[model samples]
Target: MSRRGYARADRPGRPATASAGSAPNTVYPARRSARACEGAAVGADIVIIGAGFAGAATAFHLARLGRTDVLIIEREASAGVHSSGRNAAIIREHADDAAEQALLHAGANVLRRGELAAFDRRGLFIVGPGQDEAARYCPRASGRGTWHPDDGTIDVSGLLGRYLEGQRVLYGVTVLDWTHGAHGLTVRTTEGDVDCRLLVNAAGPWAGEVGKLPLTPYNRHLMVSTPMPWVDGRWPVIWDGYRHFYFRPESGGLLFSCCDETPGRPGVYEEDPKILDTLQQRIETLQPALGAIAIRTTWVGQRTFAPDRRFVIGFDPRDERVFHVAGLGGHGVTASYAIGLRAAEIITGKLDGRDDPFGAGRLF
Candidate 1:
């Protein structure tokens, strides 16, 4: 699916360069020619770096608040090509942190409203040991669990489209560096330099480098099985909290993950073959009833996290003009709308998240 613009990259407004033959697992953004933005506007009231879920959703909320003159710069040729496009697309709002859970609830409500995209609402069944209530949610589940009839999947690309509609996004534009001074913030990119009153770093995996904050990007693997006639398409998503794995019906088959997290850098990801063995082991041990499953496709995506694991939103403590809408981690999909709304509220003075759980000050 095509995004409003190209995919976003890491290292927004930060001075960075990729060297030849860099580490295979760590990728860096390379500087591009300024010609990319030759005919586009070089100035805006707000310049947001990256067009993934964070940027798109923030732009969407800003427009709702009647704020225009926002320009989004993405390094990739399309949006959601990174983590936003690579998630499981599930909307389970059960988070260990209450602050994040609240955002997840708001975001899930946004999806169910049907304004952004189509939602499945197939429900979600979370299972763990000793609960003995798994059967309540999934008849096939053993042990204890809870059934959330509101949790389900969404059309991620379509949601991105809706959030980005009527927004000005410049794809294939790389942010070289940015500086904030008396004239406001000047962001230099491959397209050219743009002057803005505020600069938002929503560079996803690149957020750490872009905002100079403490964040790490971890890689996770997902696999889809070949179509199985016996597989039921209506089965609600089943997650095992103890086993650290989840699976749901997909395309007449099953899409599963072992929930493996490996620290890595940005850029392209090559599927790690070793994860297949890990997946098999987990499935055999935790979900053997499904029998042998043949994989049809596999992929790896990155999720960025703060040291505390809570989201890092609000303005940077070091630079108030440079705002942040990153560190959503894997919760980006489940909490995107609320994240954007919170960010917009903070930016427009409707609210201040600086001291809240999702605030950026805590990290400093």
Candidate 2:
């Protein structure tokens, strides 16, 4: 549950603070292992290894901190192909820890500041006899078992777009290998090679495979109904405390989740027909209108977690030049801003005294 240095928000040619590695701004004069160096050094001062929320957030913060010559790379053709893109898009500004509360609201603040706030302050409800644990989220309960007025929905895509517009990104770039050199690393990729002073492993589920971290992939499903004309699409999202089912309104219909989190590998996965059957069997009592409505479609996404269900952000124990920001089980979208800034701060050697609750040092 430790979060710390993920990127050294330093700009190109700036004296790097990395100890285990050096920032050799000079071009790689050495011959390429396969092809010759085309013209300019095909590398950046800092290379972000993933294009998901973590990568995008770090890129945005790094740019905000005035870092140029930085590159954000993604294996997918577009951003948010994994956890971020597939999130429920809820801005849950409810947590017990004061710092966590700040981080949660900061994410919502970024959305609102960027004009991407189409929120439902009516409240995020904790259904089915909410537990005492729910009391923290539902501070101002009107009548429900539990309700969080501060918890609202966000335009995740819009927020991401706002940050992505100013950064240099390369999509469809598959990172193949990393061979440590004199003072940095030569990253082998499907497209070509990139020599950089620093490398960030924000590769999400692939973090374990890429950076020697242990992460377990959990599969979750979401189903959308055709349309429930009678039901209000504006109603706040409902989450069952124990049943582990959740639903929110979207596009004239409701999106439902079995609250299913199954262990699996990263790839396209089929819908669990049993989850659909469960919804069909329980809809009568859950919501007659939603039950009456036919399910339009279903899909699956993977959420990754470490042994502890918290984020892993910081430098590699042995290699200071290499950093990681993965194992963000389900908090990727909710705490993207805070996590991103902290990671960038640590990497750039400007931590500004933030506590390291989710720091990777705890594991290393």
Candidate 3:
């Protein structure tokens, strides 16, 4: 790979150091040791693995609900090591799944309300065939589609910081294995064993492996063009809903994706350059008025989902102590706040999710 390739590759897939102006590093207390069977090196009432959107958002809500005895373990040195950090950071509420859409609406509302900083609220336009209703919102848009007045791009890192604010997270701690006991559970990690009454598997792309679930991770690519002077940064995100392609003004240019999905393993993504050709072909066929695009950089990211493509958020049937908040697919950012709130409610016994569309029972 070339120098630029190394830089872009580090963006979405590889586990690299936090970028400048990203989350600041925090010092964790020294690790303590305890008897293997009798106790644990660390202890908490709840232990969540993976400090990505799922884990951070859940912890945030748990704190909001007055539950402070929580601990988050992250394999990477910082949060959003994988998909959470690599995503395009667009907040779109429309979805084919009613359940997912509900969460998207709730979560996107929170983001759009200025609860967090670094949001470009230019709005979004989903242009497609027979989207007369959508066209009403973005009449100035070049094509007909639904207009999402609140939809726009966000500074993902800054948003992540808000979710992790005042949260107790231990970075660089990898969960090796865990054993559940009559009393609670003991999680074995690279740092040491952590004992907790409840465990959450929100490891994003690695959630399937961490929680022993059957979640699948798909690789997708994103490209940013060199500075396009004619591009209007205030323009809404223009997306071809039916064609699975979208683009928005970014850094004086445009960022786009073909919405390609290919099965992939956790943390292992190989950028397929051929996809650029596909993107070009789609752009030419769908909307060529913008003229030729000079690409600057490209990267690949992962999106995990269940076989049914619905979210998995409930206790594992095999073990009540283990809860899952995985499989948000590419909607993790847009749905994080709602997901965390709902997961916190269910985890705290305030809600029974066995019948919920996103419940883990459906997976069994």
Candidate 4:
């Protein structure tokens, strides 16, 4: 959990106050300080403003492409504290449009089959209490086995660890402002200023505030149960129809979610007890035998979306130097790798135009 540096708020290149009688226009010499500001105007190759899965995965891909000198800024004390950490860690198949689904399928394959050090496919299962829900996702099922034969849970922590190991991530640093000029871009953060040739706005819920781009917020909640071993059998990742409720086994117990989507502010949130109560009622109606399960912990997180629910990946239509990788809705975690790689490809000129259906042009 320890990041590369301390989270102290210290401006990197700002000159200290001049002596009381010093001339107002006196240029401060850059060589006198412990960290010289001489190269402050020289920005990085790529500057990413968020450190979640999208940002981290982008950094990883950029490094893989031999593009180092990339900087990532995060506002939280640690990475993945927002939507990336709060997600249920489900690697789902294409459940949306063709483009979105194709990217998701490609991303899932990278996690399961790629030689990258960051992914592992322990297998995933989507189960329903009745036949209707099961039939909906049946086409995407892996032939490895059925829910009855094997548990459907994925190793979410393992997946995150694989991507984050030995990476250069700046945590607890908030971006204040950024500007694109003819030469390059300038990014101002709580600690210091960064200059980069390319900029990516993968700030998640706060992406809109960082720039002129548009992003909307949506809320989702999840609940964990007190220790009980009864429901610990081969637990298939259960989806309660399209209702915002799903359950997975964890630590000799069950983790349930109402899958509720309510309009709300964007940030970390405590789970609504009423929503939990409602979810429990729904679960009981689906399976009355497990009605008395006790709740252990509950929490909520914002899922940002664009005007269209599809993801918006690629440069701003007006400014190609400023890339966008936001509005992932609830599918950010599932689509993180693909979005990151696609964003990198667009940045490096390996791809022509945004191939995903969730490209940024939809908003315009």
C-alpha RMSD of candidate 4? 11.0
> How many times do residue backbones clash in model 1?
12
Compose the digit string of candidate 1's lDDT tens values, residues 1-364. Answer: 1222332223232222322222111112323335433455567899899888899899989989988778888888666768887788888887888889899988888888767788888888787634547556555555566677888988776777778776777777788888777879888887667799999999999999988999999988888888998777877899885678899887778888888888898755767878878888887888777778888778888989999888888988888889999888889987989999999989999996656778888887
Pitting candidate 1 against candidate 4, the one with the higher lDDT is 1
Off by over 4 Å in 2: 1-41, 95-102, 112-122, 128-143, 282-290, 352-355
| lDDT value for model 3 | 0.77
Compute the lDDT for candidate 1: 0.78
lDDT digits (tens) for residues 1-364 of candidate 3:
0011001011222223433223211212212122211322257899898878899889889988889788888877666767887788888888998888989999888888766747778887878754554334433335666667788877776677777776666666688889978799998987667789999999899999988888999998888888877887887788786888888877788888899999998998788969879889977877676678987777778999999999899999899899999998989988888999999999887888778888888876
Tell me the tens digit of each residue's lDDT in model 2 across 92-131. 6655456556776776666544464244554577765545
Top candidate (lDDT): 1
Candidate 3 residue 187 Cα shift, in angstroms, is: 0.3
Model 2: how far is 244 from its true place, Å? 0.2
Error of 4 at 333 (Å): 2.1
Give TM per candidate: 0.87, 0.80, 0.86, 0.79
